[model samples]
Structure formats: C-alpha cells, structure tokens
Target chain A: MRVVVPFAAETPKTRLESVLTPAERSAFARAMLADVLRAVVEAGHEPTVVSTAPLDLAGLELPGEVAASASVTADDRPLTEAVNARLPGGDAETTTDEPAPVAVVMADLALATPDALERLLTSTADVAVAPGRGSGTNALVVRHPEFRVDYHGTSYLDHRETAREIGATLETVDSFRLATDVDEPADLVEVIVHGRESNRAPACLREFGFALDERDGRVDIVRNEDCAAE
Target chain B: MRVVVPFAAETPKTRLESVLTPAERSAFARAMLADVLRAVVEAGHEPTVVSTAPLDLAGLELPGEVAASASVTADDRPLTEAVNARLPGGDAETTTDEPAPVAVVMADLALATPDALERLLTSTADVAVAPGRGSGTNALVVRHPEFRVDYHGTSYLDHRETAREIGATLETVDSFRLATDVDEPADLVEVIVHGRESNRAPACLREFGFALDERDGRVDIVRNEDCAAE
Candidate 1:
C-alpha cells in the first residue's frame, strides 16, 4: 500500500517572525520534517510532504528521497479540511483495479516508527488510530482506500466513528511513540527523551544530541553553542 | 541596591545546536534578555546585564533603560567562574568600601518577577536562593557582597552549603515565578503560561492570549506565531 504524509504550516498568529532570526525558524522546521520523512521511507513506502511554506525547504536537504508537494489553498484553512481535501484526489492514482490501503499520517509525529507502520498495514481492522495518554489521535491508517474520513479535532473518536459509519472494523494499538505529535514545546520533551529509539531520527535531533531518561522523561541538555561560544 | 543580572550559557554534556535554528537560539536569548531587563527596571533598580556573549548594543533597544556589559573571558570556564570574574574589578578609581547588595539572577528565568526580587531584598540574609518544585534553583540574591560564592553543576545544594561555611546566612524562598527558567523547549510552555501576567511580557505573548488555570495548572489559549514574528 502507498503511504501519503500530509503536512501544513499554520500562518503566524503573532509577530514572532520579526523577533526570530530567519535562521532559527528554518532550522526548527527542517529538523522536524527530516524525522517525518525518515519514518515514511523506513516503512518501505515513499513519502510526500505537502507544505504551505514550501520555499522553506530551500536550504536544508532531507534524507531518504521523499517527494515534496504544496497545498493548493493559498488561504490557510483548518488543518483537517486542507489535509482531507488533498487525500481523496491522490487516492485514485495510486490504487490499482483492486485498490490497496493507504496510511494517512500527520507529519509532526516525532516518534513514529517503521515497525508501527508495518503493523498498521497488517492489522485486521479497516481503520486504525494511534492514541496517546492525551485524548487526540496522532496517526490513522485505513485498510480500504475507499474508506472516506476527515481527520480533525478529536480524531481518535472521529476515526472510530468513521469506521462504524463505513461498516469497517476499527482497531486500536499500543504505540507510545506514534501517539505523540509535536503540537507544543511539552510534546518536544517526549521526543528528546525517546527519539533515539526511532528508526529515522532527523539529523537535527541527532545534532541536538537528544538525551533520554527512561524514568524521568526528557531532560534538557545544554547545547554545543552553550559550550563553544559562551 | 543596583541589580546585577549575570547571564551564563551553560554547556550540557550533549550538544543539541544542530536541531535548533540559529534564529530560535538568538530569539530565545533576545526575548529572555528583554524580559529580564524589564523586570529589573520595573523593580526600580539600575539594570546591568553581564553577558558572556559579546555585547555590541548598538542597535538593540529595550523598554525603560538597560546597560549591557560583557565579561572578559578568553575561553569557556565554569559558569560561576565566568560570572564572578566580571564583577566590577577594583581599579584605582574603584573605592575599597563595601558595595551595596546585588541580586544575581539567571538570564533564563521564565517566571522572574519584580515583586520576587523586592521580596528577596527585604530579607537580611547574606544569600537567598529561590527553589522550585524540582531541584532547580531559579533565582538567587546576596545581601552581603563580601561573601564569595560560585554556582555550577547540579550542586546548587553544595553551593548553598559553601555559602554557610563562609559564615554567610543562607535562605531558600518558594517562588512560583522565579523558580522556572527556560533552558529547554518544554520550559517555554511555563513562560508562555505564566508570562501572561508579567509586566515584562513581550508584545507577542500579550497578542496571544493565555488562560492560566491556577488550580489545575493548565494554560488554555490559541497558539499564535505573529508575536514571535513581529
């Protein structure tokens, strides 16, 4: 089955861009994108990044040869609407006479693993959603390409409902890594803690030298600049 | 008493600079410095920022007034050594008489407040360290300038003990705001949360509204990038 990774940049909510050096935001986005692409390739499927800020990729290079695409809407819409609008259009091109399944992943999953994707494909359910300790779903995969669903607020519950509406089996799996997405800085702590175990940790993370404590969660590591410059 | 804010860039055992955009690091430093200066000025004290980074304050303008000074160090020594080395040296013009008490604050304190600084000065103790929930010491004020002290490593407790050994009265105060410092991204959450109430808050944080629930300790608000961008 082909995998489609959907991603978008939310427009600035404030004038934070004016304060940040251009180098900082670019570095942040590049590092995050690298890990998502790596997860896709490690799963033995090609990945595509659909970004609103497509030009942000000019300087940095990503690993594993994943393709890049831009969202059609110049006017930013809700994440679910934009991502869902992109999926159905591509579904027909990838499907054969007997259509195969597709995995729709949120590109921000910091701890996504290849093994998890493999399991997602082989699972008995028509729809699978990975839920963390927090309420929202991080990822969802459908066994039937015809399974129509829009991932948005409370996606975990939405996916389960979508499975019932489509008369397809719903499955839940225990995946600590796949359940977490980088929505807030707090979410970043989890990745810094356990990212080494992931199949494709972006070079940025490795460069950051993320240190994990199995017990205490993510601890802050003093950076190289802290040592070399000051 | 004149406030001395010594900013140290601590080097961790691991380096994570590659993941962070240069802009992010610079923005983080600039933002912190702005807030710290604002806090100092609001408390009705002369603000001197003793930075390890090169101080070229030609273009940088802050609210109220701030003085920028650089510590002369050839290499990266321990954090304590670097800060102490920059203390107003005893030149011919510099009198031998005792200088007024100074509040040595961390540059990265997320919850730093003018009220906390005033409270710290009210006590007659030789030294006061603000301790948070965990082992982290957020801010420290020394009323007695004659006593020599150094802060480095996880040995904040040992630093306090050494202060006592030198016949200096050491005290610890519980401060919710002064206890949080931003060394990692996760720490940024607290700044974004509690900073809403601070007079030193940046234009960005004020633009992005925050609902701080003191009971549950959750900040509910729509995240915005405009503040940072501006």
Candidate 2:
C-alpha cells in the first residue's frame, strides 16, 4: 500500500506564527511530519512526502528505516490541484498508471499512531476520509477513478459531494489521533496533554524548550527563555 | 428511506435497574425510543420500531407528527438474527425485497438530532455506520445486497469484518451525538449535562426525578425522592 504525506515547505502552518518564528515553525512542521511518517512506515507501508518545495532531510531526526526509505517530491500547485493530480486520471502530467487505491496521510496529524493509519488504509471503499476537527479532511484513501479532491471551504464536505456525484462509495473514520492536527498555537497543548502516550510531537516541542503552564484554570504552552538561540 | 428503530420491549435496560424500578426503566426506555423516533421523523424519514415484544405507545408523549407516523414490529429473536431477517436475503421467512438501503438506528441514541440522522442517511457508501463509544454500533445505513448486522460483542468491529468479507464498502460517521448512547447509569448524566440542547432523554430523566450532583469533583446522577413514586 502506497501512502503519501503532504508537507508545505513554504510558510507551513502560518497560524502558529503568533507563537512560533519562521525558522521555529519550519522545524516544528518537520517534527510533525516525522511523527506522521513514522506512524505510516510502522503501519507496514513506505511513505512519500509531497512538498510544495524541496525539503532538506539531512540530520532530520527520523527513525533509521524511515530516513533511509522515505522519498520526497517537489510540487508548487495548490493542495487541491496537487492532490487531485496525484489521483489516477486527475492529471495526465502526474498520474501515469492504471487506476488503483492511493492513500494520503497529511503531515500535520501529529497525534496519529500506527493503529489509526491501519484503520484508514484497510477500508474497502471507493473513498475513505478522516474528518478534521474544523470540517477539513485530514487524510483519505481514494480508490475511485472519478473522485478528485477540492480543499477550499470545508474540504470534507466537498469530498463527500465529489464522491456522491461520481457514484463512488465514501466512508469516514472516527479517530481522535488523525483528527487532531497541529495548526494553531492553542493546538500545541494537545501534543503535550496527549503526548505521554508515546507521541513524538511533544518531545519535538520540548526539544525547542517549550513547557506546559496551567495557571488560573487556563492551560497554555510557554517557551523557555534560557534556550534562546545564541 | 425506511428506518428501523429497535427497542427491547421486555425488561429493558436492566443495567439501570439499580437506579430505576422496573416501571421507571420502561418509561425511560420509551422516552428514549420516542426521542430517536422523533429525530428520524424530523430527518424526513418514516421509522419502524422493531421491538422484542409488544409496545404500547398509547401514552408515549411523542411529537404529534412522530406519534402519527412511527410504526413498530415485534420480533423475539436475538438482535443480530432479527435484524438480518429484516434484511433482504438473511431470511426466507421475512424480507421479500430485491435488496435496497435499510437504516437501523438504535432506540438508545437519546442524543441524536435531525442533523445527525440526516448525516447518516446522506452517506453514499454501501454501509454507513455511526459507532457507539464502547466498540458497539449505535446506528447504520446498509445498502449492500450481502451485508447484515451482528449485535453480539463489539458489533462495530464485527460489522467492519462482515463488510470486508462481503466486499462491501463501509463508511463511519464521526458524530458525537450518534456516538453517545444512554445504556448505563452514568450515561444519564450525559443527557442531563448535554440535555439543554432540546434532548428528550434529559426531560425523561427529570420527569422521573433525577438530578446531577457534583458535590466532590465526581459527577453522579441521583434520584430525587420528592418526585419519585408519588
């Protein structure tokens, strides 16, 4: 089973700009990507990283097998267009094989485990999607030849419509790990709270000197000052 | 869109017998059944209640439209066998149809609303399921010709296996309202806590003189003696 993990190389996760600097955001995005990739690889499948631009994987802390086998492809198209092009018959420029099942696991699903990925991959449907908390689609496995994706304005709803229109069966996977993606500054706390269950995202945040603070009944992630760059 | 709302008519919800007497438990079960039937009617589908024994809906206090439209069927077989018998080919004694979509929404999903039911009905999959929190399936819409249900241990997992074996596409609806069912004593607190959203289950509980007590950081449902057994 081939699985693709999409990572935005340029200005990734801009919502975290309030708390993370440009360099910090990039590092954190890579960390999240590594976390997602490890889950996919451990689920018994090699993963391909689809990035908006070139990614430097050197010294990028990943499991040995993952670092050795993972591949990257640079593409500048928008998410919807790029992903649709990956689906068979969506684009003659990219898709060059017979129609078959292609799985897309987004890089921002920092909390996903091998079990969650396994569930999504095993669906015997034309299209199987995991919904994002905010009505976006976090991941999908598309087997229908006519189904392509549209990522604007609640892509989860759009995918449903697309599947129905093409006479393809659609399935949704109810999963917390796949649904919780690191998008906003507030979402960082989830990584810390749910991190103790062997999640790598929390360790990534801690490596950058971030700590969880609970004061006045409010939980927040605060960065340590002593670890500032020299 | 014929929807079946299954109710166990005899000695129902024995798990709550500790908190509620036999009569009170029957009333509460009827209340929950009414709640589910109302949602189905509001979703623009007429529902049939497949009960284990005869159901007397005389004083069932349902909305006018639901009371006028909902119908019930008596079947003494186990849940899985009874439901399959209703399915097209599962039994020669029952179904005589050429296979079409049939939806089964358990009467215990007290939190379900028209919107949640509509989501399950709108799925384009061969089998669309809304899972229960404890590895059970609360509701499902089956369109596959060869698919049927098994209500034994972990029916959610069983249904998935059944679908895979029959090569039928499966979809899971990730809905909080559909996922929460009022089966255990603690589940009553959910209807009370989230009840303000026009849930009939909480109202049913209130009519039976039950209230939530959070005296010690631990929340519980305690029956009020003043309004009980008058």
Candidate 3:
C-alpha cells in the first residue's frame, strides 16, 4: 500500500510552541519528520507527506515525496481531519485496496526510533495506535485506508474507541522509544531524563543556556545547587 | 573468602525529624531498617554481620553471624579496618593461605534483589563494584582479604582508588537493584524508584502517608500528589 504521512505545515503552532521552545519545536518537528521519511524511503517505498502549511520544509533532507496542503493555515484543524482529507477518504470509513498498509504519524514525537517505527509499520495487526502515556496519539497504522480517526478529547483514547466503533482489533505493545512525545516543559524534562547520553536535543538545550539539573535518572528544571560548576 | 556485612546496630540516626513528623520518622526508620535486613536475607547470602552500633539485628529472619562493635560510631575509618578487625586479617591477602574472594556489602541496601546479588557474587572478576549512576558505592567484591578499603569522601570514587592501591583490577557493572543503599532522603528516593513493586518500606510509606509522584520511572517527593490513589 502507498505509505501516507499527513502532517500539518505551519510556521509553528502555539500548541506545539506551548510544549517546546522555538528552537526545540523546530528541531523536534524537522528531525522527526526527516527520520520518518528516511525510514519509509529506506524500505523502498515512496511516502506522501501531506502538509497544510507552506512548502518551507524544502531544506530538510527528506527522502520522500512532499505535498503541500491546499489550505492557508493547516495548524488549526484537528489531527485526523487534516490527515484524512489528504489520503483517499470518504464519508464512510476510508478503506484502501492496497496490498500493504499505510502508516500515519504525528510530526511532533522526538522519541520515535527508527527500529520502533519500522516495527510499527511492519506489524500485521488489523489496527495499531501508538498511544502516549499521557492522553494523546503519537502514531497509528491501519491495513485499510477506510478507517477514520476520531481525534477528539484525548486523541489517543479516542482513536482506540474509533477502532472499536469500526470493529477493528487493537493491541498494545511496550515500546519505550515510541511511547513518548515532547509536549510541555515537563515532557521535555521527561525526554532528557530518559534520553541517551549522545542525543543532540538535550545537549542543544544545554548549549542554548538552558540548565537541566539531572540526577538519579530524573531531570529537574535548572536549579542553583546543580549549576555551580558542572 | 567469607562474606562480611557491616551494619550499624544502633537505629539509624534520626535524620528524618526535619522532614517527617515524629510518628512518620519512627515508622520510616523501623520500616527502612527492617527492609535492609530483609533484602540481605532475600539475596541468599547469610552475612557475618559486624555491627558498629551496640544492638542486635541477628533475630531477623535471615542466617547471620553477629559481632558487637568496640566503638560507638565508626566514621571515616577505612571499611577495611572495620571488616578486617572482625576477621583474621594477618596473611589474609595471600591467595594460597587465605580463603577465596570475599564480598563486602553494607547492610543498608534495602532494595537489593536476590537475582542481582547472585549475579554480582557469581561474577569472576578479581574485584567488582556494582556502579550506581551517581557518586556512591553500594557493594563491592574483593578477592583479597588483605586488600584494605579506605572508603573516604565519596567512597564510590575512593573505592576505585583503593582497589587500584591494593593492586586489584576493578570492574563496573550496572545492577542498581543490587547496589542501592538508603543513606539520604535522595537515596531513599532511589530505593522507592527502583524498589520492587512488592517492597514493603515504600508500601508502608505510602500506607502511612508519603507521596511518591512517580514520573519517567523515578519517584519525586511531591506533596500535593496522591500516592495511594493510584
């Protein structure tokens, strides 16, 4: 099946801004989007990235087809509506005749690893939703494009409910790398707490004059006691 | 070589009075000490406990050999002094005359697990220090009894230095479950963070009234959050 990556293209939305600083938000979005595009391209498939924003993401080194949204500011619409409008969808549950499946991902997840994404896309389950520990969906894969996402109060929970409404089977898997998203300052703290020592984002935060006092595998907002010399 | 467990027989100094109410301190201390003993027993190595404080911990449900300390507080002295003072130290370092390697562990590691402890003891290294992430020594195994342990400031670092001084090779391994000791309130958070789901001290803390705002697999002492509500 044709792989579809429907992402809202705006300069940067406030919902995204509320979670990460401007630099972090831009880096997070661009990096994750590039990562997903790389994974799809490496699998010998062309990914159709449907974005509602301008084509300003040109400079990013992505290895897939880029499609800009026909709308002005695509950030205000709900997540599923934005995605379904781009892929082949109708009033009824959107189903596709493609032999394989389409993988849908939100562009804001910094925790999605290539291995985990590959596993998620290659999974044979009828329906899959990558639910964040908090109340949100990070990614989803459906064998048929006929499935419509219910992106309402708590999109993660709503997507699962939508699967049930459509008589689709759902399964939860333990994926430490893919189960997190950078949403709020605390979420960034969570990322850094579990982040790899070589990860660039946390180091970028540190280099950008943000002090993160980390100890015992927990990250606290920069505090004076931790800032003296280290 | 014989395995030696050094414990302070006197109840842990009441450092909790500043943070915990009298009732809370009493309960916390009792639970902490009890778990320490239980963990040592659960780890399957019945220790020859050399108590620095004048009290009896041998009655707990574990195989143990107890000896009372000649001093009130054994501070800053090399642990080698404390341990060797109990065992026959003369010619103890010789591989031919002395027994095999001995494991020296503090009795205050309340979160130690039998599986992890077995892993440490079964390791073939001449000397091994189970490394906790931050600066602290939880447990170590020395093949030579004559190998002196000057556990000085930040003994985790000092332990490595002492190992080098004794001409012993040092190995670092990650099994925090077997190496965490309850020394400070922050250390107690480590116990609560990685302690087994069935551990009683943290459970008792929650039962009495201590809130652990767990985030990203670590516990934080946040007050307004409900512990038992989960």
Candidate 4:
C-alpha cells in the first residue's frame, strides 16, 4: 500500500501563532510531519509527502533510510481533492493491473507509531478510519477506489456514510496515538508531556524551549526567555 | 430554583484508584463536590448534596456561607434516577403551588465557577444542558415540570431527546468550566493545571502532592512522595 501524508506547508498550524512565530510554526509543523513520515516509512510503505507547495526535503532532515525512497508532490487543491486525486484510479501513475490500497495519514499526528500505521495498513476492510479528538477523520486506509474523502465538519461520521453508500466494509481503528493530533494550545501540552520518547517533535519542542506551565488557571506552553532569546 | 449536586459518595472516582488510595479518592471527590456546591450557592440557589449514602456534612468542610444553607440527603439510586427524583414534579416535597425549577450539577467539575453556574441557572430554555468532555451531561437546568434527565450513554444527546419528547425548549450552555469534569487519571492533569484559580479542588490536589509529569512518552500525574508521605 502507498501512504500519502498531506501537509499544508505554506500556512501550517495557524492556531499555534499565539505561542510560536511563523518560522517556528513552520519548523514545528515540519517536525511533526517528519515524525509521521518516519512511522509510515517504518511500516514498510513508500510514503509520499503531498505538499501545498514544493517542500525542501533536504531542510526537513528525515531519516536517511526513509528519505531515500520518499517522494514529494505539489497539490494546491483542497485536502479532499488532493487525497482523492492521489488514490489509485484517480492518478495515472498509481493505476496498476490490480489496484493497490492507499492510506491518507494526517501530518499533525506527532504521536503516531509504526505499529499503529501497520495495524491500519494490514486491516482487511475496504475502508479503515482512525477518528481524532472531536469529529475529525485523522487517518484513513481506503481499499475501494471510489471512496473519496470529505474532511468537512464531523468527517469521520461522513466517512462511515460514504463507506456504506459504496458497499465497503468499514473498520474503525480507535488508537490513542492517532486520536491525539496537535491542534490548539492545549494540544501542544500533550506533545510536550507525551512526546518525550519521540525523536523529532519532542526535540523540536525542547529546542524551542516549550514547557508546560500553569498560568491563569490554564495549562499553557511557556518558553524560557533566555533560551528562546538565543 | 433548587440545585441538586448528585455525588456517587459510595464508590466515587474509582478511576483515580490507579494514582490515589480509596481515602484519597474520597477526599478528592468531596473537594470537587465542595467546589461545585460553592458555585451553586454563589449563584443564589439552595444547593443539596444527593449522596449514595448519608453524608457527614460536618466532616465535608464546605465553605461556611454555602454550608449554612446546604442540605444533604441519601439516595442509592443510579444518577439518572437520583437526578430525576430531585426535579420539580418527580418529588412530592418539591411539588408546590408554583413549581420551582431544578438544576442537577455533577460533583466532579473542579473548574466550575459561580458565573458559570449563574449562566446555566438563568437560561430561558425549559431544559438547559452543559455537555462534558466525551459523552457526559456535566450539568443540567430543568425549568419545565415534565423535563426529566437520562444520564445514559452520550447523555447530552439523550437529554436533548428527552427534552424534545417532553415538548420542552432545550438550551445548550457551552461553558468551558462546566465541560471540564475530572474523571480519568489524565483528567487530574486538567484539574491540577486549570483548578489553580478555583478554591477547593486545586488546594486538594496540591495538598495531595499531585503534579503533571512525563513518563514513558505519556503525560501523567505524579505525586511528591515526600509531601504525600506526610
């Protein structure tokens, strides 16, 4: 199976702007993307980074083993369109004698592990979905060529409906790593606290001097001024 | 309107047993209960504690102002039944020439504030619900006599159906404080981090030496053994 990691490279993690500068946000976004790509590549998939713009793969510093085989494609369309276009029958390059399955993994899943991705890829169902916090479709493994994605409001529910309409056996994968995507300020706390064992994201957070601190009765990310000033 | 705080005093916060002893859990549960009660009383309502067993009011150490008017009652029924029985028409004592409205508040909302409770109490709808994280009905205000509660799975959804069935106007009160209920071991992080501005819960968590720490690539609550050892 081929894995597609859709990344909004141009204006990624807009919600984190309150804490991170635009450059910092981009760096953090790339770090999370690299972590996700590492997991997908470790799961024995030829992962493709579907970017909104041309990504500087050299600057990303992905693992050498995975980086060697990884590919990048520029797709300015909306996420659903980009993902649908990348699926087997939609793209000329992906069409084969027998259609291979495709998995659309989100770029912000900093906690995703190789085991989690392998479980999703190996599922027998025509459609396998991992639901994120709230109503998001975090990751999807689509075996059916006609099953297009809708990343609109409550898209997980919509995916289930879409799967049923196309007569695809839908499998739901409830994974803690997949469910927790770094979105809001509160989510960054999750990354700082839960990502110690991870390579890329935790190192990025530490480099930025991001630490969890309580302020005004809320768990917030605080940066050491001296370290950040450097 | 009368406010009922239904506390599962018998086996309260069984989920916290991984981190807290049974006595510690009970103390923590009572601390959260006091916080909710304090908010209810500050909202200018007579609050009652509906316990699974007869509560020792003197031992609870509630705020003096709230404790003066607060009452306690024993009811071993399920949460739905206990809350429904406390509503206007369900209880004979609560039935009057002009029925007063009822608000059922959960005891585990460590972040609840007086202003939050006041907003819920003053809502014009016949049934006002405050939805918690996941599928919980955090708090509910019932102005219509026929409006009862069902604290089953996805209870906020069930409450909406219950309101519709009874021909009551349903209002959803979206309060962050009301939504954050301390349940799992992870939830204690929320309480320790966000309850700083609050009174009882924060103090209790601190007294118990609860602090957020990272271990094994997961965010977890760690207690200072020296402080807890005391």
* lDDT values, one for every candidate: 0.53, 0.78, 0.54, 0.79
Regions of candidate 2 where Cα sits further than 4 Å from its true position: A1-230, B92-97
Better structure of 2 and 3 per DockQ:
3
Best by lDDT: 4
Candidate 3, DockQ score (0 to 1): 0.05
Candidate 3 collision pairs: A1-A100, A9-A53, A93-A146, A94-A145, A94-A146, A95-A145, A95-A146, B1-B100
Worst 10 residues of 2 chain A by lDDT: A88-97
Query: Candidate 4, residues B162-197: lDDT per residue as tens digits?
Result: 888879999876455677778888777657644636
lDDT of 4 at A20: 79
- Compute the DockQ of candidate 4: 0.02
User: How well is each residue in B1-230 modelled by candidate 3, as lDDT tens digits?
Assistant: 34566765444535545455555554555455555555555655545555555544443422232112111224333455776554334333344454566776666666666666666777777677764333345677777554555453345556777778877777754443544556556555545444567666777666755554546533355443343233
Runs of candidate 3 with Cα error greater than 4 angstroms are A1-230, B11-15, B21-30, B58-80, B84-96, B186-200, B211-230
Off by over 4 Å in 4: A196-198, A214-219, B1-230
Q: Candidates 1 and 2: which is better by DockQ?
A: 2
- Clashing pairs for model 2 are A171-B171
Q: Where is the poorest 10-residue window by lDDT in model 2 chain B?
A: B88-97
- Candidate 1 lDDT over B1-230, as tens digits, reads 55556654333211214323454455455667667767766677666656555454433456425543222223245456654543433121144666556566676664576776666656678777764322445566665544544553333455577677778788765444565566544444455544635434334344443222222322223333443332
| Candidate 2 CAPRI category | incorrect
Tell me the alpha-carbon RMSD of every candidate.
Answer: 18.4, 14.3, 10.3, 19.2
Count of backbone collisions in candidate 1: 24
TM-score of chain B of each: 0.72, 0.92, 0.70, 0.92
Pick by lDDT: 1 or 3, better one: 3
TM of each candidate vs. truth: 0.42, 0.53, 0.47, 0.53
